[model samples]
Target: MTTGQALVAVRDGTFLPGPCFMPCVDALLYRFRLVPRSILVMGPVGAPLLPP
Candidate 1:
């Protein structure tokens, strides 16, 4: 999906949008892993993993 569409999904609490292609795929992969939580960052550079 396009960034805008993904953003809408996130805003509507349906799904999260990653900032880039790789991260988006990663998110989809991990999503089925049953992780209790996740994070999504927004910026011109695209979504990147935040420092823990």
Candidate 2:
């Protein structure tokens, strides 16, 4: 799969149980203007985008 597709999969997988969580993911993705290649899932700021 493409990097963007994989990111979408990971995001959906994590937030699928409670779709409400998708807004945050979506907002982040929107702000970045593209799906992230990798995510850093820790820290007060939540998952940060990795280098492409």
User: Which model scores highest in lDDT?
Assistant: 2
Question: lDDT by residue for model 2 over 1-52, one digit each (tens)?
Answer: 6999999998778756544666587668757867543442342245345433
Worst 10 residues of 2 by lDDT: 36-45
What are the per-residue Cα lDDT tens digits for candidate 1 across 1-52? Answer: 6999888767656333333454666566567864333433233244235432
**How much is the lDDT of residue 42 in candidate 2?**
41
Compared with the true structure, all predictions reach lDDT values of 0.50, 0.60
RMSD to native, candidate 1: 11.6
In candidate 1, what residue range of length 10 has the lowest lDDT sum?
35-44
Segments in model 2 whose C-alpha atoms lie over 4 Å from true places: 1-17, 35-52
* TM-score to native of every candidate shown: 0.26, 0.31
> What are the clashing pairs of model 2?
none
